[model samples]
Target: MNIPDPQTFTDPEKLRKLMANAVRLGYEDLAFNCKLRIAEIAGAAQDDVIEREFWTALIAAEEFKAAAAGKTSRLAKIRTKHRRVGAQRLLADMMMEEAVSDGFETLVAHGRAELTCEAIVLRHEDQFSVDAVNAARKKLMDHGVAMTDIAA
Candidate 1:
């Protein structure tokens, strides 16, 4: 299955097709069980770019926090970044609900799956580690999810 390019993920029809293909190809996260509901934003109207920006900023801040672990100054910067992005994300939550409603409808029509990363983590909690989570996040990001989309 070809991963859709994040930069070019702006067409609703194409996005739907991409999602369908992902499901067909067993693309679990973004393609099928999209917990982040990113598909909704992928095909949103041009006026909704703020949602994308907010997600991008939040993702970057999360990445910074992960990479800068014990760096107090870096963590401080991340805290500030998160505060700003969190406000934007909160403001956009309603629109986000509206945007994802269509996709949610589609998922429901196709039989929604309730599997989540937490489930997987619980199943293998004995060996779960920061490194493993990081690795999985990298794999998911490479498969089309943004860094922020992956939660530990």
Candidate 2:
């Protein structure tokens, strides 16, 4: 998929479509490229620009979730549940749910995933609270993963 210049792209719908297509195609570098674009867009003073970056960050988060989930039965389960609860809410809630229901290793993995999602959103939109990321970090620490390890 041809991703338009993030800075020059004026049509939000088209950008969204490109991002979605990139994700569906398993574009490995999409997240990195989107993150760079988002960082550049973050300095914009316009509300609309910030909102567009927010949606873009959400797409990156979804891509991360898909990559992390892989082709496991868990991924299939998540897909079914996502259709019912919606993607935005599901991404946030699923991590907590999985952390509670799964084993220690799974909990740590989910905590790291949650941290990544929170970090991505926070990086693009500072209006978001840091509490979620902090909680995720604390959960990981509780499970014996060092703070330095989490940071890395």
Candidate 3:
């Protein structure tokens, strides 16, 4: 499935159409990934309202399609059980360490830091808080890394 560009997310009509196509194609995972990507983008944009709406609508569509097909919602399967306190912090720390060890400086130089951070957060969404992700992105920016240097 062709994923809509992140820049087009600001257009509700376009986003809705893209999601509908995903649902029709039985690409629930694609829809979910789009939601995760949007979450990262929305956090960067400081637009929680649109993110929440997008999240709700996408989940609903996925659920509806799953019900019609007599299958469980992929979203339900992806949600992890609640974790112990500090577990998320540990995961965030490990992720940061791995990023640094992977030559994050080079990634920043190539204008990939922001997308890299978003990918990390989305890959471990259940184990990281939005605040932690935002802080990491901010730290990169504070070190003279431009978060908006590259288009995703």
Candidate 4:
């Protein structure tokens, strides 16, 4: 199948309508028409209505999020908990980076002994990043330790 570009139009009203339709159809149907409408109304710039769509998408998105939020109490709780594990990993990663940059290593005692710094970023010994270093910086506080310098 072929997918069309989302920037073929230039009218706000049309884009809004298409977005409404896409929202009505649920976020899954972000089709060619929908993307075109968005790109067009966004003034042909990719981020034109970044704020508007953010709020609008949330309003349009709540139904899906809520539906996914549960089928039963226990299952829903598990899903939410699973989602939170990402946040925990993020926090632990931060602590690791902080320790490493401060010229020491950290022990992430999350029920096991894992050297946080050793897991990410290769030092002089040619080691692999243990996912403690992000694929790219997801947080503002961390830098790409390789080929990057702290702004002075």
Best by TM-score: 2
lDDT of each: 0.37, 0.44, 0.46, 0.33
Model 1, 1-152: lDDT tens digits are 46655445554456556656665777745443232233334324235443443343333333223323423122244336446664233433322222322222222233321112322232343444555444434433433444443232
1-152: candidate 3 lDDT, tens digit per residue: 45556355764445556656776888765554554444444345434432333233334344344435556444332123112323234336534552442223434543445334333444345556676666566556566765455234
**Model 2: per-residue lDDT, tens digit, 48-142?**
54334333434334434444565212334544665687544543553354363232244245444323433333333343335544544555555
- Model 2 spans > 4 angstroms off: 1-72, 84-88, 95-98, 101-104, 107-128
Name the regions of candidate 3 deviating beyond 4 angstroms.
Answer: 1-91, 95-99, 118-127
Which sequence of candidate numbers ranks them by TM-score, best first?
Answer: 2, 3, 1, 4
Task: List candidate 1 stretches off by more than 4 Å.
Answer: 32-152
Q: Between 1 and 2, whose lDDT is larger?
A: 2
TM-score of each: 0.25, 0.32, 0.29, 0.23
The backbone clash count of each candidate, in order, is 0, 0, 0, 4
What's the TM for model 3?
0.29
Give the Å shift of residue 43 in candidate 3: 24
The Cα error of candidate 4 at residue 106, in Å, is: 31
Q: For model 4, how does the per-residue alpha-carbon lDDT over 67-146 read when each residue is reduced to its tens digit?
A: 23432112243235436663234334443443332111111111101112222222211222345434223222332232
The superposed Cα distance between candidate 3 and the true structure at residue 111, in angstroms, equals 3.1
* Per-model C-alpha RMSD: 16.6, 9.0, 11.3, 15.1
Find the candidate with the highest lDDT and give its number: 3
